[model samples]
Target: MAEDIEPLPVPRRIDFDFPDDIDPNWKADDPEFCAMVNGASLTMPYLEPFLIKTVRETARHIDDPRVQEEAKAFNTQEQFHYRAHRRFNELIKAKGYPELAGLEARMEAAYARLSTRSLRTRMAYTAGFEAMTMGVTRWLINNRVQLFGGSDTRVASFILWHFVEEAEHKCVAFDVYQAAYGGSLGGYFARARGVFHGALDVMFNSMRGYKIILRKAGLWGQLRSRLRLARRLGSFAWTVAPYLLRAALPGHTPRREREPQWVHDWIAQYPHAPEGYIPLLDTHSPTMPVPFPSARAATGAAA
Candidate 1:
C-alpha cells in the first residue's frame, strides 16, 4: 500500500556540488545527449518560476483544500528544483556557451508575456505541460542507467531526485486545472491545445538553447551529432507518444500513468537519507541500488 501511495511534494534541502571546472557533460561519454538534457535544464529557471506564478494565482479560484495544499507543495518543490538547476546551468554557461544567456533572456521575456494571459489560459498551459511530465519522468527513470552511467554523481543524483518529486506531485497541476474549469467541453479543448502548445514551446526553446550551446562546442554541424540527436529524439517520441496522447483525451487523469518502481523507492528512501548532501547514485555499482540511509552511510564511508 505504501508503494501504491505517493508522498506529498515534500521539500528536500540536500546539497549538490558543482565546481568551477565541472564538465557540463555529466553524462561523461555522451555529449550529444548532454546537449539535449542540459538544454532542457537551461529552461528550468525561467520556465518553472512561470509555472509557480501561474499555479499559485489559479489556486485562489479553487475551493478544494487538498488541491490548494498540493499546489503550495508543488510550488515549494519547484522552487528547490529550479534553484538547483540554476546552479548547474551556471556551470553550463561558464563551461563555454555564453550565447545561452541570449536564450535565457528570450525565455524570460516570453514567460513574462505569458504571465499577462488570462488565468484559464495560463492554467491550461500548466496542466498540459505537467501532463507531459508523466511521460518525461518515465523516460528519464526508464533510461537512468544508460543516461547516467558513469556520470558525475552529484549531477546524476540531483536530476533523479528532481524528477522523483515530479513523479510524486504528478497530479497537482492537472487537478488544479480540473478544479478551476470543472468538466466543461471548452476546458477539455483548452487542455488539449495546451498539450501541444506547452510541450512544443518548451522543446522549441530547449533545442534552440541546444543549438547555441552545441555550436559553441563545435558539435552542432557535425554529421554524427546530427544523426545521434535525430535517433534519440525519435526514440523519445516513440516512448512518450502514448502517454501524451492519453493526457490529451477526455476523462484522463495523471493517476492512469503508474509510477515506476524507482519513483516509489526514491520516496521511501529519501526520508532516511542523512541530512546533508544527497547521496550520489553509485555509478560504478551495477545494481544502482536505492540510496537508502544505510547505503548513503556506506558510500560516504567508502569515499
Candidate 2:
C-alpha cells in the first residue's frame, strides 16, 4: 500500500501573522521567565541541522516528486525557525542568561548520537518527533493565554508563528516514511523506540534547565516552591502523556477530533494558513542540491 502511495511533489507553505498586543521587551524585567524562554529559544538552532540532515538523507528513498518538494519546504521553514529563535535566544543572553551555553552543549551531544542511525531509522524517528511536536504546537496555540500568562504581544506572536508552521508540516515526515518504507512492523517498532528515547531526553534536559532557573531565582530551597514545581510538572505530564501513549498504538491516527475545540476553531479559521504567505515549491526534483552523507558516516560518527 505504501509503495502505491506517491509523495507530494509540492508542499503547501503557510504564512503566519504576528500578534501585535504583546510587548517585545516584556522579558527584560522578568529574570526567571526570561531564563525559561532562553532555554526554549536555544533549542531551535540545535534542532535545525538535525532536521536538514534527516530530510536530505531520506530524500533519496523517496520515489514521489511531491514528497521531495515537501522535504525541501520543511527544511526551509525549519531554517527560518532556527534563525528566529536564535535572535530570541540572543535577546535572552543579553538579559543575562548566559548559562544557556551549557544546556546547548548537552543538547548538541544528544543530537549527535541520533545522527548516527541509519537513514530509515532517522527518518522514522523524525516522523514520530514531528507528530508529537504538532500536538504540542496545536495545544500551545489553543491555550496561548494560559501559556504566556502576560500580554507581551511580541513573545506571544513569535511563539504562535512557530507553532502555526509546525502544525502545517506535521504530516510531512510521517507521509515520507510511509511512502518510502511501507509502514512495516519493523518500521513501527523503530519509530516507537526512537520516540521513547527522544521523550526521555527532552524531559530530562528540560528539567535540568528548569532547575537552573530555580537556582538562579533563589527558590531552590523552599518546600512550597518545590511543591509548586511538582504541580506544574504533573500538569504538563497529564496533558502530554495521553498523546505519547497513543503514539504507540499500531493504528494510531492523530485526529483533530481529540484535540480541544479551540484548536479545531483555529484550524478552521485559518484553513489557508499553510499557504497564506510562504511560497510553495513549483516542482519536485529527484536530485537534491545537498547530498546527505552516507549511512556509514552517520553510524561511524555515532560509534
Candidate 3:
C-alpha cells in the first residue's frame, strides 16, 4: 500500500476560537459528553507532541522515503492539532475546573516516562494511538449529528476538522511501523502490546479527566450522570473495539480500514484555505464546501 497510494498531507492551519460566550457544556446541554470531551482535550497538548517525538525517532530507523515524508507530514498535522486543542483547553479550564491543571500535570508525567522507552516500543505506541484515533474519527464522523447537534458550531467545526485530518493521515503510523517490522511474529506481538497499552492509557487518562471535571461539577456520584457516562462509554467501545481488534490481527494494515463515506469524500474534495487558515466547516453536511471567512471573521465573531 505504501507504493500504491500517495499521501496528501496538506497542512491547513484552522483557527477555531472558543470565546467566553461559548457553552462550557457544548454538546447540546449534555454535561456527561461535555466532560468526556473536555477531559480528552487535556491530553492533546502533551500526547500529540509525544506522538510526534516517537514518529520522528522511528523515522531514523526507516529507509523508505515516502514513509519518511509521510511521517514528517504527520508530525506537521499533529503540531497543528495540539496547538489548536491547547487553545480550546484554555477555554475548558476557564470554565472553573481547577482540577484540570492537576490532571494535565499527571498526563505530562506519564508521557515523560514514555519518552525514556526504546525506539521500537515508542513507535509501537505511536502506531497504537494513531490506529485508535482513526477508529474514533470514523465513529465521530458517522455519529456527528447525535454527538454535536445543537452545540457550538465553531467548537464542533474545530473538532471535526481535527478528526478529518486524523483520517487523512490514518495510514502513516501503521505504514511506518510496518516498514520497520511487518511480517515477523515479533512485530505482530509488539503491535498488540502497544495497542493494549495505548488503549489502557487513554482510558485511564480520560477517566482521570472525567473524574476531575465531574467531581468538580458535583456530578461524579450522581446516578443520572453516571448512567449517562456509562452509556456514552458503551457506545464508544461498541463502535471502536472491533477496529482495534482488527488492527491487532496479523498482516492488518490501516489501508484496509473502512472509513465513513463522507470522510473519504472529504479527502476527495481537497478544499484549500488561505495560508494559516482553513474553511469554516459545515458540520451537518461535511461534504459541502463553505466559502472561506474574512480575516476578521476567522479570528473573531460568532466564536
Worst 10 residues of 2 by lDDT: 282-291
Off by over 4 Å in 1: 1-7, 295-303
Give the per-residue lDDT digits (tens) of candidate 3, residues 1-303. Answer: 355585657666767777888766776568898888878888899999999998888889888888889999999999999999998888888878766888899899989999998777888888888889877887778778778766677877788788888888889888888888766889879988888778668878988998888888899999999999999899999988988898888877888886777665555444443466544555464333332554324435745
Instruction: Report the lDDT tens digits of candidate 2 across residue range 1-303.
Output: 234343232232333333333232354344344444445567778766787788778877888777778788888878778777776666655554567678888889988988997887777667767766755764564545455544354555566656656666665776667677746888778767656655555556656766676676677687877776665456556666766677766765443314444333333433343334332111121211111133224435876
Cα RMSD to the true fold for all candidates: 3.3, 13.3, 4.7
Q: How close is candidate 3 to the true structure, as a TM-score?
A: 0.89
How well does candidate 2 score on lDDT at residue 99? 78
Model 2 clashing-pair count: 13
What is the Å distance of residue 294 in model 3 from its true position?
16
What lDDT score is found at residue 161 in candidate 2?
Answer: 55
How many steric clashes between backbone atoms does each model show? 0, 13, 0
Candidate 2 at residue 167, lDDT? 68
Q: Write the per-residue lDDT of candidate 1 for residues 174-194, one digit (tens) a residue.
A: 888888884789989988888
Which number leads on lDDT? 1
Better of 1 and 2 by lDDT: 1
What would the C-alpha RMSD of candidate 2 be, to one decimal place? Answer: 13.3
Evaluated at residue 216, the lDDT of candidate 1 is: 84
By TM-score, the better pick of 1 and 3 is 1
Q: What value of lDDT does candidate 2 attain over all alpha carbons?
A: 0.59
